[model samples]
Structure formats: C-alpha cells, structure tokens
Target: MFKPDGNYPLQLHGFLRDQNKIWTLSRENYEALKNVQTHTFDVEGNVVKVQFNPARMTSTSAKVDAASISTRRCFLCRENRPPEQNDFHLDEDFYVLVNPYPIFPEHFTIPLKEHLPQLIEGRIMELVRITSELTDEYVVFYNGPKCGASAPDHFHFQAGNKDFLPVFEKGGIKKEKSIWTKSLFSAEVSGIDDGLRKYILIESGSPESITAVFTHFDQAYRDFRDDDTEPLYNLVCARDGDNFRLLVLLREKHRPSYYFAEGLGQILLSPASVDVCGVCITPRQEDFYKVKEEIIKEIFNEVFISSDQLKKLEEII
Candidate 1:
C-alpha cells in the first residue's frame, strides 16, 4: 500500500533496497535521524512516531550469557559441514552452500568454519584469494557485521551467478586513489546513491586483481575508519570479458527485526535474496519502502551493543 502522499512518517525516512526490500524515506523523517534525537511525523491521518534510540549502544538488549556461545549452533560451522545437498567444498576452512532462498538459481555462500568476528582483515584476504582461484566468472562478496550479516558471530562470505546482481552487470569499474596513495576503483549503481559517499561497480578476473582490490580496500579501510573501528560494508565482484565488474557498498547499518518478522521486506528488495536467507523477510512494496526505514532505525537501535561488549569485540578484532 502506498502512503497517500507517497511519504513516510516524519520520524521514519530513507529506503533500504535488498533483493527483497526497497524503501523510500520522507525527506522530513530522514532529517530527524541525527546521532541522538527523537522525532514524530504524520503518517496519513495518524501520527506514526520514530526515534533514534541509542539504548543499544548503552545497554544490552539480551544478555549473551556463557551458555549462548557454547550452545550456539553456528550454521557456518555445524550444518555446513560435509557439504549439504546443494553445496560443495571450496577449501579446507571454507565451503560453498547454496543460498536457501536463492535470488538467482545458483547463489552460494562461501563461509569460514570458525566463529571468528566478521571484519576485514587476514581472514577476508584468504576468502578473496580462494574465490579468485576457484572461478573467474563468479561474483564474490562480504557484508560486514553492521552491513548485512545476520550471523555476526560467524566469519563467512557469499557469491552468486554473474547475472543476479544487476548493479554489477550494469556498471563499469573506474579506478580511484585516496590522498595517501592507496589505489581504489568504483562503479556507479543507479537506483541508490548517497552523494556524500561514492558507491562503485567492480570485478576481478585474476587473483591478482582481486587481491589488489581487497588489499587496497583493506588499506582504505584502515585509512578511512578509526584504527579502533570498522565501517559497515557490502561487496560484489563480477567478470566482464577480460575484466570484471564490482560493487563496493560502504553503508551505515542493517534493516530492523520487523523487516525479518514480516516477509514483505524481501519483495521490496527484489533481485537479492541474500537478506531473506540471512535476516528479515520482505514480501511487498509498502514493506519495502515503508517498513524498511522503520526497521533500519530499529536495527540501529537494537544492535548497538554496550561499551563493555564493544571493547571485547575490539579486543578480538
């Protein structure tokens, strides 16, 4: 159902597009989202309200008691072992499991077996190296913990048949460089663009190119982010003849639990089932455009762990 005026409540704004969800935010609501602020807005005749809740950063929504970790059945570690029916082994520490809700017929996940923290470092390099060696025609990617990884506790990566991600197929890679001499490149994705940040398309035909891209990004990661932190991100790399198309996403956060609780989240982000398989469900248009923004705010509020937990995560990272 479209908002009567095609606008969101003032407190909720911005759109989130995944394979199943695409949402638009009202300009007024988008403006209310400062680091710590609460605002209300009109939704049709009713006033639907939203707030930037920082309790997540200040408090623990649910305790991660000792039992949680030991009892944790990490799919990347347990169910993925020995390779499921639609899956195959990629390497010793990594395996390719078919995306249960495939956005494309041959979508797969290349997840690491260990319950390592999901961050770009030595582990990601290994994943990039392996994927490069395995095939020249696949798209390989990683969605950072705050970006799209629902299983933030497990370290894994994903891939899909080249045609699934239109953003990659449609754009061409362009080289870039930071002031510090770190080299990088990007391709533009049309549907979404944040003028302040440059989103680009990318591809890797050789391990060297993949390595270069990852290495450069890793360096940029180090350069752009605080030495003590990570900026949420997502990636897509495709092959185009002798070259490749890649999409690198530097994002702010993930969708909220409501997106997952309601299936419509998937329909809005049509074209990418990754979120469906990983987190929320999106079944239709309103869910995509309306609920996505509300949930994003919710996700931001919910996942902001306490300083103690953040410190622990930092120590491990």
Candidate 2:
C-alpha cells in the first residue's frame, strides 16, 4: 500500500525535507509550491481550480517535438536526475520518487527503471495495481505521451493526495449516469458523462480482467483516432473497496487553439490528466487570473473526443 499506517507520507516528507537542503531545483519548486497562487470558479456545476506555478513552466512549455526531445537529456533517467532526490524501487521496472514540481501537497512521480518512451500500450494495469495499493490516501494517474507528459521520453506515472482532486468530491459509479459498455469477462467499462468531462471508468477486482478490458479499449481508441500512433488521452486510477476504477479522459487535442492564438485569445495554460479532472494549470500569473468558466469549457470541448469519435468507440462494444 502507498501509505501503510501513513508511513510513506512521513517517509516522503522526510525525503522532501532532506532534498530541499541540497537540491536547489527541488528547494525552489517547494518554495514555489508554498507561494503558488490559485483561483476556483464554478463551471457547469464543476468547481474547477486554476493554479499559477512558475516552477511548472518547464512542463507547460515543453517542446515535445521529436527533434527537440532528442536534443535534450532525459531528466527522468537516474543518472540525469538530481543527486539529492531519493527513490524507492517500486518493482523491477519502476521507481517511486517525489515530484519536485508538485500539484498536490504531497506528490510523487513514478518512473520506469528503464529509459523508455512514454506510451500506455502495456502499462495500464500497473496503474490499477498502484491505485489499489494506495486506495486510502492517494490516487495514481497517467499522462499520455502526446497529451500531457513532459518527460515523454521516459515512461512514468504520477501520484497525488486524493483529497485534492475534485473528482473524489463526487459520488461513485452507482450514483452517476453511465453508458456501460461490453466488458471482458467479469470486468466492466462504462462511460460517464459528468457534464464537465467525459470519463470512461473501468472496474474490476481481477488484474487479468482489468487488463483485458483496458487493452481492448486502448486498441479501439487507437483505431478510432486519425493518426497512426496511440490516441491522445488522459487517465486516472483509484480503488473502490476491493475493485479498481480506471478513469480515461478521451482527448482529441493536446492544447486548445487559444494556446497559440494572438492577443487576448492566448492563455498559457496546459491541460493534463489532472487538469481533465478539474485542476487546470496556468504557468503564467496573467493566464491564471484571466481564466473564466467560458475558457474552461472551451478547453474541455477542444481536448475531449468529439461525439462522432466517441460513437466509434462505442461501436467497439
């Protein structure tokens, strides 16, 4: 479990305390987290929060183009990471480390041990497992390589305090409207239209069953997308009793048109998996103050899968 008797929380806080003393970047980010500005507004019944954290500019303004990515050293790689940062070996292939630029009060970045390209092709089940283990205190999340990952060159997942996400503030699947899709074996896949965002939640107790349903959904999404690569999407996973819930945020675009628009149209905002769940990030102070309900709605509209694309996914059922 992630926070067994809440020891992981203490251990991580200790790591952060130690890192801040020697790791300048980590210290700076921690300071930024303390002073980060935020504003919340109700949008279509969803109270979305916008944050201005200058430390996150690296991620928000990441140049994910192949050429640009190749030219830079992969920071997620062990040798490239700051020496003061501590990590716990999660498995033969992943390491759990505190995220220096944090979104939650206590945030973690779990990266693959091998330096691998970021892709969800075969890793979705791991997300479910991690979430199940940390059910009580934290939620595990994934950022699709093209959707929100700043370190797409290195496969990784992020974890954050569950209380911070607005999604947890809502009720469970039984209380929400959903379009239950055909699932694999005993597993279940259902699309929830939560007015704020379209979410596909996968539920199952068996890892094998969960993997089967997600693998099927992943393929269907790729086939439905126009590009020849993995489709754009954001994901989050948490546990519900003995079962795991995988929330998929189907995306069609990485950034809204306003990201590149001129004058008032431009907002230096980057929508990630967390953002899809109601906590949008604005690296610039001006952008954070300028955010309103209409702009928030527009971002969702641009990034979420179109109605036709979604219908094609339902056809998979």
Candidate 3:
C-alpha cells in the first residue's frame, strides 16, 4: 500500500538507517566527497570546473558495447537489486532510491518500474515534475544513452544537489549571442550561444506552456538529427517558484578518439552530460593531474555540434 503521508527523501533516510550496507556506502561517500580534487579551467573566457574522483572509474571506464551490456544482468530492476537495497515508490511505475556511487552531496536514481530501453521519447515533462517536486534543493538531469548512461538499456533520470554544476553557479547567461529565435511562434525561449557552449533555455510559468515548448524543441532537434527517435543531447531541468527552466545541450558525438589513444597521449576520460556542462570528471589520478585547458576545449569541440552546424539548426528551428 502507498503511504499517504510520506515523503520520498525522508523514506530514503529511514531505509538508509535500516539497511546497514547502503548506510555504510553513504557514509563512505562523505569521505570521498572530502577527497575530491577540484581544478578550474578557462576555456576562451568561459570557466569550467574539473573534478578528479577515483571512485568514478567504474563509470568512466565502463564498456558500453551491446555485447558487454547484454552479457550483464540489469542492475536497476527490482529482481536484480541488492538484498540490502530499498526504494520508495513514487507512483505505480517509478521508484526513488539513494545512489550508492554518488556524485553529489545527496543523489538519487529514479528508474521506471518496467524494463525499457533508454529512450527519452514522450517523457520530457516527467523531468520537469521531478525537478519541480525537488525544487530549490535538487536538479533533475537526463543523459542520452550513447552520451553517458552506463545502463543504457534502462530508462532513468538522476537527481543531484543543486549549485554543484558550474552552469548553475554562473547564474544568468553571459555574452548572450543572437543566433536562435527567442520565440517558437508562441512560447518564450532564450538562447545562450556565447560560443563557449550552445544552450537553449526554455521557460514557462505553467506546465502546459512548458510542455508545448519542450515538445516543439524536441521535434526541432529530432528533425535536425533526421531520425524518428531520440536525438543526442543532455537536459537539465529545474523549477523555481511559478516557472520551469529547461536547459538543452545538443551533441554530435559520444567520445573523442583521444579516449582510445595509446598510453601517455591517452587520457581515460569520457565526456557525459555532467562532463559536457562544465564539470568534467576524471576517474584516473594521472589524467586528472595532466588534463589541460586546451584539451578540455578540444573535447568540447569534438562532442558538441560545430558552430556552423549549430547555426544551421538555429535557422531550421
């Protein structure tokens, strides 16, 4: 039975108390959080924070090929979950659980009830609602399957403590470029094309308007990809007061060839949604120490749509 007067975060707190294993991992996270190495890089004037965390090696080094993924059992599914793991049911089809390998002060992984492929079709608003419910404290983000998701077979969204990302800390847009239209026929849109990174910020005080804008933007992105399915992108949605703010980062590729390069030149790093949006993750100690600003700029250039292509998409939108 669904608990009538319960909150998901509070429920997770209780579960952590009862589940010693998860509780211990959560405690370990506190220690890892302290040891995290931080470096600030200036990319042609825009700043990005680079973090070296040894604990993230699993995600950074994970092989996401179809055969590798198929050989392994799904971890997010209830039947495959750890015996000590517990979750708070958000509804009939989703559950909220503490992320053991956390990247934030407090993190969560919300997975669908059914086993499904990692596709974001028809689910943009759920990202809005989750961010709305966790407003002011958490930011809900979606990672495209080919972009960063290790479990690309399972549909999910990650919630992390707010203000940790450099994009949020930067506050309002800087050096705003006038490339994309600020209005999509009816709804309001803001474009931050400072050349540092192309961003399409959509805002609406009402969910209905927000939904329409997101749908329209998604359709534009799909058309740009020239396909009938999910396009490559990273989305971060946050709700404030009566307004919903959605930031879309368009992508062109998954990982650069440098990632697969031979030793000394090879830096074992994989740029994900989080990585692309200014908080690059370095899972290995050596790479973290050796990574440079020019390298960071190159990675962004490789993963993101070129300025020329971005302008083309803007014209199309």
Candidate 4:
C-alpha cells in the first residue's frame, strides 16, 4: 500500500522537492521561511526560542471549536486537499505530506487516511513505531484535539527535524532531572516539573512496554481530570537507538489569556507540542518582539498543569 523504494527521509526529500516544483502555496510558504525571525529567552535556565513566522498566522489563529469546525471542510481529507498537493503513503491508513505552514526546516503532516477525531488513546504504539522507522532524523508529535490540533475532526501526527525542539537537546529532561521516577510494564516512567512545565517521560527499548505504560497513564489522567474526552496534553516521541523517549507535556489550557487579550495586550501565541518543548512560535512579529522571560514563564504556567496537579498525577499513575 506504500512505497517500498527508499527509507522515510530519502522519500521525504524527493517528495518535498517534487511538491515545491508544483504546489505554489507550499512553495511560496517555504520560500517565505527564509525571512522568519527568531530570538531566544532564558526562562529559569530553559531556553525558549521565539519565532516570528507570519506564514503560520493561519494555524496560529485557527478556530477549532465544534461550531467553527463544523462549517469548514476538513483540510486533511484527501478530497479536500489542494489540487497541487500530493502525498506519500506511509501505510494503508496513513499518508505523509509536507506541511504548507511550517515551523521546522523539515516538517510533515501525517494524517490517517480515514477521517477521524484527533485522539491518541490506543495509538501510542503506532507513534512509537513511526518514530522508530523514521530513526533519529525526525521527531514525531501529536497535538491533542483541545491542545493544539487545528483539525480537531481528523486524526494525524506531525514530524519535524529532531534538532529543532530543545526538549530533546542536552539539559532537557535527563533522568536525574526528574522529580520522580517509576517503572511500569518494563518501561521507566519519569515525572518532571521544570519550574515552567510539568510533563511525564516514558523510556523503554520495547515498544510493547511503552504502549502498555502509556495506556495505563492515559486512563489515570482521564480519571484524574474527570473528563470523558482525551486529557489535554501534547506528546513528543523520539527514537534513541532501540529505545523510545516519549514526552507527554501535560496541559491545563489550550491558549493562555494573552492570546485572547484585546488590542496591544494580545499575543497570538499558542502552546502546542513544539511550543511547550521550548520553541514557541508567534505568527505576528509584534507578538514575537513582545515576548520576554516573564511572559514565557507566565504563558507556560497558565497552560501547563500546576505542580499540585502533577504531584497528584504522579501519585495516581
């Protein structure tokens, strides 16, 4: 059902090149990336990269509310996709396509062939497997429906160059940095509260073990939140040799108050997997310039689950 010609990165290289030759919107957006401005702020030692990418205004300002979503066609659906856009089948159920609006140098949107809600309850293993297949070249991430996903009506995963997100870099989530650690289903699970963000990390060489632990944690989180819907969170998975490191960034809100603020106080920042990971994107140059260490800390504190909640989750899980 999918190409057997080359590995993912190789196939993606060709796919991107071919798409750029034909897809005007994608080509133009990518070309616009050359002028994107970026700066860094150190929030309690954690470096947060703030990018001024105007092309991302579409996604940054997207309305994923049920009412709003109902009125629009699903952009991820094969029939609804732009005519010039093309896809590389990953499997019978998924297709990999270059992201027209990008934050990473190499970015892709992998969508399920079938139209489905954005949920990750039983799909942790699929994410792990895809991360493994992509090897060390890319990191795969999932934005929970209410977390950061624009297409809340469709199921998908995004992949980007692994080096772009600082959470995977040194000084980010070492075992020693974890506030607490436990072993479940042969996987090592660590809970971290890095002053600004509260997240859970699961590490294991065995995909089965990782999947089992994730399932266990997912239920616990759902129960703790007392919500039927999937818990609000953003997940990042990267393959480390035979082991997979999954970072589940817990969330309390989708967008911070600054996002809805009026006039000069408004900041179009949205915290997603990539944003929470250290690279925050602002589609407006003014917002990017307005962001500072205090703002970063405040935004993170507002969106992420509180230390009390994380402690409770640690005990429950």
Top-scoring candidate (TM-score): 4
lDDT of each: 0.42, 0.78, 0.75, 0.89
Cα error, candidate 1, residue 134 (Å): 5.2
**Per-residue lDDT value at 202 in model 3:** 77
How displaced is residue 82 in candidate 2, in Å? 1.8
Error of 3 at 277 (Å): 2.3
Q: Is candidate 1 or candidate 4 better by lDDT?
A: 4
| lDDT (tens digit, per residue) of candidate 1 on 1-317 | 11123221110111111211221221222232233332333221122223232222211122224355457565666654433233344556875554443333344567776668777666544654544443444567777665655456778787755443333333222233211122233322221222112343334444355556655555655554555466655665544445544455544434434434645433222111233222232333244345434443344344332223322322221
Model 3, which residues run further than 4 Å from truth?
A: 1-22
Model 3 Cα lDDT, one tens digit per residue, 228-251: 777777888876666777777777
lDDT of 4 by residue, 1-317 (tens): 11234587888888988999998888888888877788988787787899889888889999999999999999999999899889898877889999998888888999999999999988888898888878888999999999999999999999998988887888876566678899989999988888878999999988888889889999988888888889897999998777789989899999999999999999999889999999999998889889999999999999998888887777887
Clashing pairs in 3: none
Candidate 3 local lDDT, residue 245: 74
Output the better candidate (2/4) by lDDT.
Answer: 4
Better of 1 and 2 by TM-score: 2
| Per-residue error (Å), model 1, residue 75 | 1.7
User: Comparing 2 and 3 by lDDT, which wins?
Assistant: 2
Off by over 4 Å in 4: 1-5
Q: Alpha carbon lDDT of residue 46, candidate 3?
A: 68
Candidate 3 local accuracy as lDDT?
0.75
